[model samples]
Target: MPRFVFIGLLLLVSYSGMPQDKNVSQGRSTTSPHMAWEDLLQEHVQEDGRVDYKGFLRDKQRLDSYLETLALQPPKEQWSTQARMAYYINLYNAGTVALILENYPVNSIRDIDRPWVKKRIQVGAERLSLGDIEHKILRKMGDARIHFAINCASISCPKLPAYAFTESGIESQLNQAARGFINDPQRNTISPKQAEVSKIFKWFRSDFKAEGGSLVDYLNRFLDEPVSKGSQVKFLPYDWALNDILP
Candidate 1:
């Protein structure tokens, strides 16, 4: 072979042999591990949205797997707003489930010492409690609709939807959750004469105001029977009983 041809062949072989960063070269999107958690929730939770802690305990391994993924693979900052919101919402809900299973058979999540504020489980590159995900992350994200999406494993907390929140469907799910929680007579007894709402509205009053306006304004937006102006605003006492369904 001619010297020039041999040199060219050697250069081509060397270039082909160069290593590429698998993560960078392929430009792979992050695969969410939340699917495992979502599947577990659907399988164990009743159609009414109450959870079966006993069944969740039985599937401890699956729960742990989901948590492991969360601890290691939290959503990247580069992701879109919807993706981040969906990720944190799932983390909060799934983490809450794990917290319940930690003390399975307990009557209430409050039975534990400051369960929400407790820093125990690992998630998103750090050990974060339920409160951290809710207050520190989700709340700062500036969407009041999150209150309806994150369940605290309690009777008074918003219902856990049968399906998990996804980046693509988060907007719709949030809207549905807001409407469901507000309009549900059981949770919030909104009357034209006297408006009674969930403690959530009272607790996160600022969020609702930010979302729309005052609590009454927010309620009127969803409520079929609008709460009349100057209607009595009363917050119902929160129930701390475990939102569990018996088999």
Candidate 2:
């Protein structure tokens, strides 16, 4: 090979060997390469969605490392819809856990003053609150299924999944989450005549109705037994108790 051609090949190989930045992706795909959050979730979260706060406390360092990675790499507009959805959902869930750890031993998230409004989450160059991520970011994405994916660390809120959300599986994972939350009798009760559901439906009525039709229409999508279109719907009193595992 010519001397100039050999030098060019050497430079290409040298650049390729350099470590790539996690925030930068070469293609349309934009998802985290590794999810440390999944390991923590599998270890501390129960199958029933109850959390072992003590266990989380013991693994605080791991959780913090994962959160730091997320904070340094915020989602970009060029990312696919699934990628952004998964990122925000995971960010909200992980941020909630970090908040709880900051105030461990509390009975409920409500005990913390302005828990959702507090701007404690640091994502890239932006500092946001839990509410900002949920309402301003995720809700605006126009996917109502998001209501079931982001947890509020309360019994009435949707259960936190044991695995992290991935861009590749976000569609299926979201469908499963919606079905699980709607059918979980503890959270919702549906019949052909009347239905009683979690306050989530009431609080964010617009979200469920954004696609048009009544709340029952949305419930029927995931419910085993469909509620009548004109059936009476009642919102259950939200349980603000912490979803902590007991010995």
Candidate 3:
């Protein structure tokens, strides 16, 4: 009888000594791991739009720990209008990169469509397809400017900002997205006679117009040189490839 009691006490002590999840320790509980957008942006951004993926990978363990906490938090009560938008934007960007990494070393994102990497990933409690996030959450959500924000990890895709999403910075974020994309020589740029533009402006011209006028008119607000009347617009070929920074 005494031996049985001693064994039971030993088991209890061992269980108590087990490490607890970090999120519980911090008082913010979550199931999955994620880094807040604010913290990510502060640490990653360079003067140019280029983000430091290497730095992110360096402290990946802590970042993953935080994300686990975020996931455990209960699903939000009625995604706030602004918060929903912000979450979708973050989802699309983060999910896209995560998707790309699933099949790294591919020539283009197209190759991943074969069998394995094309499978759905659960992001923020939503099982999302790369297309669903791009079309449904982003486009169907009634926002057109997103085309300029989420990077496909390609030179042609709009530069992905180093920071995370915040409601306070939404307007400025959209403005910067617009300006940076339009100014990218590979995405959209004006030369005296010949000009190149992103398929984004072509694919969703109506989305932009819903807010006011033509995309060119919308773009002119940000460009240094005025877009002359009746200037021809041509689509630039996009490289849908993995944007891995080779070591």
**For residues 1-247, what per-residue lDDT tens digits would candidate 2 score against the true structure?**
9999999999876543312223423321233443578778889999999999899999999988888877877776667787788888988999899899999999999999899998999988989999999999999999899999999999998999997887767788899999999999999877789999998898899989997888999999888878888999998889989999976
Task: Extract clashing residue pairs from model 2.
Answer: none
Model 1 sits at a Cα RMSD from the real structure of: 8.7
Clashes of each: 0, 0, 12
Error of 3 at 29 (Å): 20
Q: Can you tell me which runs of candidate 1 are displaced by over 4 Å?
A: 1-32
Ranking by TM-score, best first?
Answer: 2, 1, 3
Candidate 2 vs candidate 3, lDDT winner: 2
Off by over 4 Å in 3: 1-78, 114-119, 123-125, 191-195
Q: Show the lowest summed lDDT stretch of 10 residues, model 1.
A: 18-27
**Candidate 3 lDDT, 4-80, residue by residue in tens:** 99999998765333122233323222311223544564575454555456665665554554444333342355545
Candidate of highest lDDT: 2
Q: Write the per-residue lDDT of candidate 1 for residues 79-170, one digit (tens) a residue.
A: 67887787788878888888889898899999978898989878655788888889998999998899999999998888987666666667
For residue 26, model 1's alpha carbon misses the true position, in angstroms, by: 30
- CA lDDT, every model vs. true structure: 0.79, 0.85, 0.60
